[model samples]
Target: MAKNNTRVRWVSIGLTALIIIAGIITAFLQAQADIEAVNTKADAIVKTSEVMKIEGCLPSRANGNNITRIDTRLDSMQREQRTAFKEILRRLPNE
Candidate 1:
């Protein structure tokens, strides 16, 4: 009878330990998922802000000044790109 009691006690202790470990693992995974969700929301907010900035920079029909500024900016960007392409072509080896 004493041997049986000892075996029962050890089995209960093992089951309790297993339950505690499982709870800890579940909590850790939940925390990780929460962190990922927050990061995803942050990324979405950043992307939204970037799109808003671009929209603000673009010209609207009601704003003639913005249209002129955007056209000037586009012209400068095209010139810079053309210059960079010419430089790249100059650097290539003749085949």
Candidate 2:
């Protein structure tokens, strides 16, 4: 009888440990998903801000001599594309 009770106790402890482990794993996965979602949103916001900046500088982009203009829009991160475009434009031949 004592041996049977010991076996049952061990089984209950094993089950409790299993439940705890499963909860930890679930929490870890949920945290990872939340991080990925935040990262995706951040990337989208940065991309949108960059596009708006380029659009805002459209007057300077009217000229056809603007390949560097496109590259500059992407390179400045959060600065004015015109600033970089002007520098890059000077290096190119007149078009």
Candidate 3:
């Protein structure tokens, strides 16, 4: 009976030790996963910053030229409209 008790105690101790080791391993793995997540986020932020730098805030040359062309065309249209209105006013009989 004593021998059986001794064996049972050893088995319980072994099981407790295994449980503690598993808990420690689980904690270590969790910490590693958290670190990897942070690294991945940092990498993504760096990539985004690089993209922003390449794209820039201001319009490209082609876009700027197009905007200038549009503005000139609008000014020409406005001048034509003013001339047409002046001609119409000259044709109208004075009261």
Candidate 4:
């Protein structure tokens, strides 16, 4: 009976240790998964921000003014080209 009790005690202690180790490993795995999820979310946010920047969602006043100025210059240049072409056509001799 004494030998049986000792053996049972050791078995119980070994099972308890195994359970503790399993719990620790489970916790570590869960933490790793959580960290990966957070990193994925962070990467997604960064990509979204980059896309928004490229799409001009975060335009500054200075940039807006510069774009407007560029557009006005382009329009002026087009008008000048059209006028020059008309003048050249008028100067040409008719067949």
**Which candidate achieves the best lDDT against the true structure?**
1
Report lDDT per candidate. 0.93, 0.89, 0.92, 0.92
TM-scores for the candidates? 0.60, 0.58, 0.56, 0.60
Q: RMSD for all candidates, in order, please.
A: 5.9, 12.2, 13.1, 13.3
Where does model 4 exceed 4 Å of error?
A: 57-63, 66-95
Model 1, 80: alpha-carbon shift in Å? 51
Better of 1 and 4 by lDDT: 1
* Model 3 lDDT-worst window of ten: 57-66
Which residue pairs show collisions in model 4?
none
Report the C-alpha lDDT of model 2 over 1-95, residue by residue, as the tens digit.
99999999999999999999999999999999999999999999999999989897786657765678768777775566677788898999997
Over all chains combined, what TM-score does candidate 1 have? 0.60
lDDT score, candidate 1, position 62? 51
| Tens digit per residue, CA lDDT, model 3, 1-95 | 99999999999999999999999999999999999999999999999999987777445654764667778999999999999999999999999
Clashing pairs in 1: none
lDDT, candidate 1, 12-75, per-residue tens: 9999999999999999999999999999999999999999888876656457556678789999
